[model samples]
Target chain A: MKVMMSLTVNGKLETIAVRPGATLLEVLREDLRLTGTKRGCDHGDCGACTVLVDGEPRLSCITLALQVRGRRVDTIEGLAREGYPHRLQEAFDREGAAQCGFCTPGVLLSAAALLAGNPHPTREEVRDGLAGNLCRCTGFQKIVDAVEAAARGEGDR
Target chain B: MDFLIEQPDTVEEAVRILAERPGAARAVWGGSDLVVEVRDGLSRPEVVVDLTRIRELVEVRETGDGGLSLGAGVPLEHLARRPELAERFGALAEALRAVGSVPLRFGSTLGGNLATASPAADSAPPLLVLEAEVEIAGPGGRRRPALADFFQGPRRTVLGPGEIITRILLPPPPPGARGTYLKFARRRALDLALVSVAALGWPDAEAASGVRFRLAAGAVAPTPLRLPAAEEILAAGRLDEETRTAVRRAVEAAVRPIDDVRAAATYRREMAGTLALRAVDRVLRTLEGGVA
Candidate 1:
């Protein structure tokens, strides 16, 4: 049986009918057409499906769609407001943090959550914050640099 | 992947659904473990009773006896950031941080960790040393059991039919005691521990041994178990180089590891003692705020 669940995604309220066992990643990518949330490893080991549920970075791949009912979910698409991109996203661009861009969305969201709580994180903190996100393209050096740059407000300029 | 999901607002209601369904139902909260199991065909439940909606299972309260009552549904990340738990129960705080990742920890619960009953559970070794108790709610009522006796084997626990772990009761740390948890994994983050050891100790000048130690290890046995042989050695006298070596050897001898995909039984046995020694050394460190 499919359950009708209403959730706030990227500040937009949406009600959709989903299977009882459908994953949030499935609903985000398949049902709502919100493909910004990647589906790397459906088993939750790969954090490519990371999203912010109530402002916490959670793996959408393993999260049940029904679990997020009535909760605020922020995806990578929400990182940019209108034409302006989030500082972390811009910093990634400036630092060449992304190559294939497969893991960029999840990494950006995880970085967003980390910076939201810690505006000025240390290099080690940035590494630890982004540890869950894996990027086979760039050996994480550029990604770490990008996160630190964003934390330093380098992207503002 | 095909199952009825029931969200109960209270523990009583949750237990009723579980009792009614019996073997057909399973309790789930922060499905980090259960979701993977279901997807991998390791677990199949016709109905999943989601307990995240239960208010009583998501709090951390002082037990009014200098102890702490940790609600089963409280996320591991939430507990890791708790100042009281961090200050009083250093080993537990360290162990919680050693779990999956920041986000994974946010979605994994203490109850879910214990319910899975994995021998490699990071939370078990520390809780065992702290003498934590698990409070189980069933159709009849609630019963608290020692955390030591909670596990029967890998993916097994003492929880009976229709029973759900409601909370974990943590006794207050002994006066002047310090503790530490050492987890040996291939990598730091997102890797299950190959061998883990937790130790809690305090100086006791009047006692026969002049010190008291509680030592336990994980991922080296069927269940997380105390290294009584090592604990007895430490309790015998002062912790000199000889005593440390004896403790290490005792731990190596006490553990009954198995050959698994993660590590060989021999490697696990050896590392378990090494980590145990490191944990003891860390717990006995004299520097203020040095112990984790």
Candidate 2:
């Protein structure tokens, strides 16, 4: 059975009809057409579908679409303000952190979440924060450097 | 995607819906595990009751007696960082952090973990050692059961029809007590435990062993088991090499490990003792003024 639910996505209120069993990932990409939130494992194992729910990083692949009703959801699309990219995105681009870009959205969102709580995270802390996100390319050294540089406010947009 | 979701504002309403629907309805917290089950066609419920909205059910509070009451809906992600909980129940905090990744913990709940009743549930061994009790709500009202007696087998518990775990009660740990939870998995990030151990010890000069210890292990048996045999060995006398060897043998004897995809039965049996000893050593070190 489909249910009508309302959730704030990317600072915008969206009222959509969704199946109860549909994951927040599905609703984000299909129903709302916010494809920035990638779906990787379709289970909780992979962090490819991570999103911030009420300011906390949560797995959207396992999160029921109706579960986030009336709650605030921040996807990769919302990580940036207006047309400017988020600091993490800018750092990723400058550091060449993304290889295939499939895991970029989830990785960037998780990095944003980590930095939101700890603005000046150490290299170790960045690795810990991004542990949930998997990157087949670059071996995460560049991603760690990118997050650390972003934390240091190196690349100002 | 074939079910309807019911978000109840209170426990009473949630219980009512569960009672009226029986097997047709199920209560979900975070939906990290249940959602996967539903998606995999392992469970096909007509309705899923989202219990996250019940404010009282997710709050972690201190009991009047200095103990703690954890609402079943409290997420592991939030609980792992709670300094108050970490101060008293350090083993539990460690176990919570040992579970999946940061994002997975955000959607995993203690109650949901207990409800799933997997033998490898990371929270079980610590809660077992902590002597926690579960508050279950059903059509017949509420009943509190010791966490030790809560499980029957894998994916099975004492939960009755329409019964939902509402809260977890943890007694205050002894002053100066030290504990540790150690998990052995294929990979630390997102792998289930092949064998896990939890140990909590407190100094007691009057006791025969000169200390009191609580030991438990996971994934090696049908349920998370309290190591009474190992505890008995440890209580026999001083913490000598012979005593430690006996404790290892006791743990190996107590666990009923089986060959599974993640591990072999013989290997689990051996590591169960190894981790149990390591956990005990860490606890002893902390109790004796050494760093954990």
Candidate 3:
């Protein structure tokens, strides 16, 4: 089944044909080639496929492609500015948050959503915001620190 | 695949299409659970009825009768944010808040939770405790059924082939009554329950007359089970140590759990008793006039 969907991805408008069964993760990665939105569990269990749907972190792997019609989607790739790293990306780098980097993109997106919603989130809020995303590396302390750094506006420095 | 139909206008239209094409269509709201089920091949339907466009099903209104009539499409996040729901039906609000992570909550619907019919569904136990009833629409007409009678088994509901749940009616909590919902899981969020319990209490000994102690246990039976025996025990008197112990025993005895990936049968049975006791104690301490 094919349906016409108009979506704004990473600030760009796109009209694409999507199947009812096609997931947002598939469209983002396979159709748009935005591989930054990694496919983790395909189910909602893992946050490895997290992305920003209208500035809110969502599990893209389980989200239907057609469901995002007329909605805005932001992937990790969208965070980059002019070949440079976004603040979140830089923080993840300096704090060594991306140990394996397999979970980095999703965690970064979730953190980005949090920072966008709350400029200065407490440590507990950060923990809660990223609760869906799992990281097998960095023991999660560094990821928390990275988000904290981003929130403090220290990522640029 | 023939085609996909995205009808988001009204429940009447959704139900019309569902009845016209039964096996080919499935309703989509929030898409938190349905999308995953479709992707995993657990469900396959040709036409996807997107219910997010239905404005009527998204409302949460206070009935003139002092009850709450929640649209089936109301998001879990919205339910969690309602002050009245938090104050009057604290257990249901808490259960909604405990579902999945924040993002998932934003996309999960109360109707979706009920339709999924998972025995471990977080919202079921609380809704059961609230004595909630569901209004379902089908080709024939609309029918209302108690939440207890809605679930047939795991992932199965009493809904007809083309029936769509329209609203959930929750009776107002009695004055001086407070409720609490507790779930035990291995992780902090996005985890299924090992065992969940919802307990409501009324503080006034006299006003508490005929006060129902609806106990809904999740993940401890084929479907979410209401502990009539436990409710009977609590109705006898104040929830003291003795009454609490008796209620716990009744809950443990009523549940017939099985060993699964999430937990062992024995653990679920034990936690049924433990969670019932803890929830009763918490409600009594917090709301029942500081009673033990």
Decreasing lDDT order of the candidates: 1, 2, 3
All models: lDDT? 0.90, 0.89, 0.84
Q: Against the true structure, what is each candidate's TM-score?
A: 0.97, 0.97, 0.92
Which runs of model 2 end up more than 4 angstroms from their true locations?
B288-292
lDDT of 2 by residue, A21-119 (tens): 788999999998899888898877778899999988899988888889999999998888889988888999999999999889989988998999999
The sequence of per-residue lDDT tens digits that candidate 2 reaches over residues B154-267 is 999999888889999999887678789999999877779999999999887666887888999999999999999898778668877888889989999999998988899999
Clashing pairs in 3: none
How much is B127 displaced in model 3, in angstroms? 0.6
Candidate 3 off by > 4 Å: A81-84, B1-3, B207-212, B238-240
Candidate with better TM-score, 1 vs 3 = 1
Q: Write the per-residue lDDT of candidate 1 for residues A1-157, one digit (tens) a residue.
A: 6899999999999999999888899999999999989988778887899999999999998888898899999999888988799889899999999999999999999999999999999998888888888889999999999999988899783
